[model samples]
Target: MNKLINRLVLGSALCGFYAGLSNAAVLEVQGEIRPDPSNPGGAQIINNTPVTGYCTEFPGMCGMLNLRSNTFNISFHSSGSIPVGHVIPFGFPATWRTFTVSHSSIPGETAEIQIRIAGVGTRYRLSQKAQEIVGLPIGMDEFYYHTTLWGASWVEATPPCRPATEWGRGADANGTDFTVFWLTPEDVTTCPKSPRYVIPGMSLQRLDVHYELRAVRPEKLIGGNYQGSYTYSMGSDFDMGSLNASDPSMTFNLNLTVKQDVKVEMSADRVYLAPKSGWMEWITHGRKPEKLLGDLRFFILSSSPFKMDLNCERPGIDTCLISNGSHQVPVDIGVSLPSPWVDDTGQPIARRPLKLGGAGLQNIKPAGLPNHLPSLLHFAVPQDSVKDMQSGSSYRGTVYITFDSDI
Candidate 1:
C-alpha cells in the first residue's frame, strides 16, 4: 500500500526601489508608480510642483491641465527680464513648438512633450498714447478689457490666441489677469510683426507653463527607474515668447520610477499529498493508485511583467526528487493563475509546468492589475514512479518558488 507522504511549503523575496536626479536651476519633474488596491490603472502621474503664475489668476486653465489623468504640471516661478542693451524688440517668437525628450537611463528611447496651455504676466506699456491707440476695432473688446492700444480687446475670439482655435490649444487670455495676455501657439505668419510687437517698453513679469506628456506606456517597458530631459529656448519659441529676456532657456528633467509590486500570500503554505480521492480504496481493496496529488492555495498581486523560479532540496536530471529513510521518488509541480493574468503572448497559465530555472514563468503581464487574486500551486507524483515506492514509506522535500519582476 503506497502512503500519501509529501508536504510542500512557501516563501518570497522583493527586489525594487525608486530613484531621481538633482540639479540647481534645472527644473526637475518627478513621478512614481506604487502598489495601490484602489487604483486600477497601470501608473498614476502626480503633480509635485506648485502652479504659481497660472493657478492663481487662471483657475480655469489650471483646472484644465489637471482634468486629464496623464497631464502633469510644473512651475517656472522666475520671470523673463527684458535685456537693457538690445534696442529693437524682436518678433514675439512662434509661441508653440514640439519638444523631444530622451530618456537618461534607458538608451534609444524618447517621448514627445507638448505645451497644452500657457500664461504670462507683463506690463504692456507704450511710449506714447493718443487717438492712434484707438485703431483696434471697438467690437473686439468682448471678454476682457484690453487696456493698451496695440491689442485692444484680446477677449474677442479670433485670428490667434483665442481659446477655441484647433491648433491654438484652448490657450487664450484677455488683459484682465493683471496685465497678462494668455495665448497658445502661433508663428510669425498668423500673429505677424503687426500691433502685437509694436510696443515700446514692456517687461515680462511672470510666465506659467503646462505640458501634456506622451510617455512610453508602463506596460510596454520593463520595471525600473527611468529618466529624461528637455531644454527649451525662452526666446520667440513655444515655451516663453520673450525675444529679448534675461533668462535664455530652461530645462525640464523628468524622473519616473516603478518598484514592480509583486506579492504572494499563501492561504495554505503546507500541503499533504494523497491519491485522487483518498487512501481508502488503495488500502482496503489493494488497488494501485492512478496518481498522487496535492495543491497549495495563494493570493498574488504583480504590478508588472514577472517570472517565477523553481528550486529543490534533492535535484534530478530534469525534475526534483523526494526521499524517505530508504526509498526515493520524483515529484512534479505546476501552477495556475486566474483571469487578467496571462503569459507574454496573452495565454492563460493553467497547469503550466514549473521548471527548475524559471522556464515556465517568464515575461507575463496582466490585462488588469492582479489584486490578491486566488491562485494555486500544484504538486503531483506520477503513477509510474509511485508503483516503485515502498508501501507505508513517508517521503519529504521542499520546493522554493520565486516571483521576480526585474526581468
Candidate 2:
C-alpha cells in the first residue's frame, strides 16, 4: 500500500420545509440518501407537505388523495352536471341555486346530483429545486411530468361517455387510476354524462376532481424539493369541466414536493501509501520503486448531482507537495467513480486529474444508480517526481477531498 493519510469533506444545503398556503398551498416532497439500512440511497421521492392545498380547499368532496415515494395520486376538483335539456348558457356565467322544497319533507332529503369532468389538457411546471441545480427533465415517460393519471378508482365514471382523448383514454373505458401520455391541451368534455347521486346532506354546489402523478425516479434527479401545480378554469367557456358556482372558475392548485438525501462514506478511515505490493518487490529484490501511489476506497450514496475538489493542508508548502527536512516534491491525484456516475459527456470517471488550486472536477451526475456504490481516490508520485527522492526517505502528505452536492 502507498503510505498516505486521508481526510473527507462532506456538505449538504438541505432546504427548509415550506407550508402550503391556505387553499393555494404548494405540495412539498422530500427524500434522502445515507448509510442507513432501510433506505440507503434515497432512490425514491417522498411526500413532505403536511397537507394538500387543493384537497383542504374541498374537504368532503376530495374523493381520494394518495402521496407516496413512487406513486402519486390526488383529486383536484370536479363540477356539477347539466341536467338533460338543462339550458346551456354559452356566453354567460351563472350562480348555483339551492332550490328547496317545503321543510315538510322529513327523513330522506335525497338529491341525486350529476357531475362531469371535462377533457382539458392543462400544463403544469414540475421541478426539483436546489441552490445549484435548476430545471428538470419533464416528459410523458420521463420522471417529472409523466402521462396523466387515468384508469384509476379516483376517476369514477358514469353512463353516456365519449371516446377517451389521447390523455384520458381510461376515463372512457370505464374508470380506474391509470396513465396516458400527455398531448395537446384540448378543452372538451371526455367523461360520461350520466348523472351520479350525491349525498343528501352535502351542498348542491359541492365540486370534485380526480387525478394522479406518475412515478418520479429521484435517483436520476438532484436531491431536493420537487413542487408542481396547475390551475383549472371552470365554467362553460373555461377548462377541465364546468363550474355552476357564481364564480367564473375556482382555481385548483395541486403541488408535488420531493426531498432527497445524499452522503459519502470512507471505507479507509486513514490512508497509507507506498510502492506497489507493499515494499516486498523493492526490499526483496533491492530495486527502487518506480512510483508511489495509493488507492482509497469510499462508499457514495447520492440522489443529487455533485462535483469533486481537492485541497492541501499547510498551504504555503509545495502546493501539491510532500516535504521532509526543508525539501518537498510534487505529487499527482485523481478520482475514479463507479457505475451510474458519469461526467459531462456521460462517461464513467476514471483517473480524472485533480489540480491543487485549479478548477476541480464538475458536472458529476448519476446516470440512475439506485444503490450506494464504491469509488476510488488515486494519490500518486509519478516516475519523474519519484526519481528526486533521497534514499531511505520517509515522506508524508495531508490532502482534503471535497464532495459538493450543491450542483
Candidate 3:
C-alpha cells in the first residue's frame, strides 16, 4: 500500500480567476507517498512552485501567467517613446518633473506590476541649482509597477558622466558601474537578505514618476498603438525595457522622463590640527559656508563658520617639556576639526565653509621642552575628512604656526 503526507504550498492561480468567472480555485496538493509496488521503496511526491508559463494571445502578441487557460493569459513588455530634445545636465536643487507614461497588455487583460530603470549614469540633487553635481553615469529606469498605491511616482535616472560628450552609434553604452533595482518599500523593508546590488553612490535622489494603465486587445488592433510618450533627453547612453523583462530582450522608448545629472552633498564630522610652537593665528581661506578641498579658492581657514581648532599635544605620563625661565620652551601642538565637503563632477567640493573661528587656537607657547637638535610635529587629521573625497585634493587646510620670544 502507498501512503502520502501533506506539505504546505500556496499557488497563485491568477489564470483561473480570469476565465469567464466559472472559477476553479488553484488548489495545492501536497504529500509524500510510498512508491507503487513495482517501483519498490521510493515514494513520489506532488510539488508546486509558482506556476509560470507564456501565452501568445494572438500572432506576434505574447503574455505570461502564473497558471494557464484557453481565453486568458497574462504578460507584459516595456516600451516607451522619447520626445526629441537635448539631455539636460542633471544638477542640484533641480526637480525631475513627474511625467506620465502608459503601458498596456496584450489581449485586453489586467496585469498587476511595478517599474524600474537601469543604465550607466550619474545621480543628482534637487536642492542646489547652478552647482555642478559630481557622480558617475548610470542610466536608471523607474519602478512604479510594484507600488500598491501609485502616489507621486518618480524614478531618478543616473548616468555616468555629466558632459556625456560621447554619443553615437558605436560609442560604449555601459551606463553606471552598478545595477539599480527599483523596489517598493516592501522590497527594501520586507526582504530578509541584504542587497547584493550597490546603488553606486552614497547620495541618491528621488524622482516623481507617474503611471497610467490602458487595456487593449492585440487581435482587434493590427498596429501596436503605444499607450503614451515621455520626454527624455536625446543621447546614445539610454537603455529602456519592460520592468522585469529578460536582459537580452530590452526595449527602447523614444522620449523618456527628463534626464538630468546629479549632485552629492557631504559634511565633515571631525577635524584635527598640528601646530608648532610660536606659530599663532593659522589664517585659513576658502569658499564661504563650505570650504572644499579642490575649490579653486580652496585654502585653510577661510571665513566664518568654517572653524579650525588648536589643541595642545596630549602629554604622556611625566612627559611635559620644561621651559627655561627667560625663554619659554617651544613645543608643537596638534590641531583637529570635523572635515566636510560635497562632490562636484567627481571632484571634492566644499559644502560647509572651513572657518578659523572654532576653538581659536592657532599657536601655543609650551612652558618648556627638552633641548633638541631636529624635531618634527607628529599628528593625524580626522579620517572622515579623507573618506569619500576625490584624489589629488587636500581635505585639511594649512595652518601657519609662529613662536614668540619673551620681549
What C-alpha lDDT, on a 0 to 100 scale, does residue 317 get in candidate 1?
Answer: 52
Estimate TM-scores for all models: 0.54, 0.49, 0.14
Local accuracy of candidate 3 as per-residue lDDT tens digits, 1-407: 11111111100000000000001112221221112222222223222222221121211211211112111111112133111221222222112223333324324412111222211222222221111112222242222210111121122223221111111111112221111222222111111111122222222221211112121211111111223332332122122211121222222132111111111111221222222221132224321221111111112221011112321222222111112222211222232222231111222222322222322332211112212122222222223422333433222222222211110
Top candidate, metric lDDT: 1
- Cα lDDT, all candidates: 0.50, 0.39, 0.20
Candidates ranked, most accurate by TM-score first: 1, 2, 3
Off by over 4 Å in 2: 1-215, 224-228, 233-259, 284-289, 315-319, 356-360, 370-373
Best by TM-score: 1
What's the lDDT for residue 363 in model 2?
A: 56
Off by over 4 Å in 3: 1-307, 311-407
- Residue 221 lDDT, candidate 1, scale 0-100: 43
Please say which candidate is ahead in TM-score: 1 or 2.
Answer: 1
